[model samples]
Target: MIKYIEKLVKKLKTSEKGQGMVEYALIIAFVAAIAIVALNNGLGQAVKDAFTGASNMVTSASNAAGTWATHKDT
Candidate 1:
C-alpha cells in the first residue's frame, strides 16, 4: 500500500498536463479572497455610494434638460 501511494505521488509530481488548470484555480481563489476582504472592509459600500451618486446626478441633469426644452417651446 505504501509503495502504491509513493508511485502515485511520484506520478503527480511529474505530470504537467493539468498544471494550467491548477494555476487558474489558484488565481480565482486569490481574487475571491480579495473580493471578500474588500467587501468586509466597506469597499463594497463605497462603490455602491459612488454609483448611486453618479446616477442621481445623471437624473437631475436629464430633468433639467427636459425643463429647459419645455420652456424654450413655450
Candidate 2:
C-alpha cells in the first residue's frame, strides 16, 4: 500500500495532463482579484461618473444646437 501510494504521488507530480487547466485557473483567479480590488477602490464609480459626465455634455450640446436652429430665422 505504501509503495502504491508513493507511485501514485510520483505519477501525479510528474503528470502534465492537468497543467494547462491549473494555469488557466490561476490566471482567472488573478484577474478576478484585480477586478475586485479595482472596483472596491472607487475605480468603478470613477468610470461611471466619467461616462455620465460625457453623456451630459453631449446632451447639452445637442440641446443647444437644436435651440440655435430654431432661433436662426429670428
Model 1, span 1-74: residue lDDT tens = 99999999999899898899999999999999999999999999999999999999999999999999999999
TM-score of candidate 1 relative to the true fold:
0.84
Ten contiguous residues minimizing lDDT sum, candidate 2: 65-74
Output the lDDT of residue 65, model 1. 100
Predicted candidate 2 versus true structure: per-residue lDDT over 23-72, tens digit per residue: 99999999999999999999999999999999999999999999999999
lDDT of each: 0.98, 0.98
Q: Lowest lDDT 10-mer window, candidate 1? A: 10-19
TM-score of each: 0.84, 0.70
- lDDT score for residue 48 of model 2: 99
Instruction: Tell me the RMSD of model 2 versus the true structure.
Output: 2.6
Separate clash counts for every candidate: 0, 0
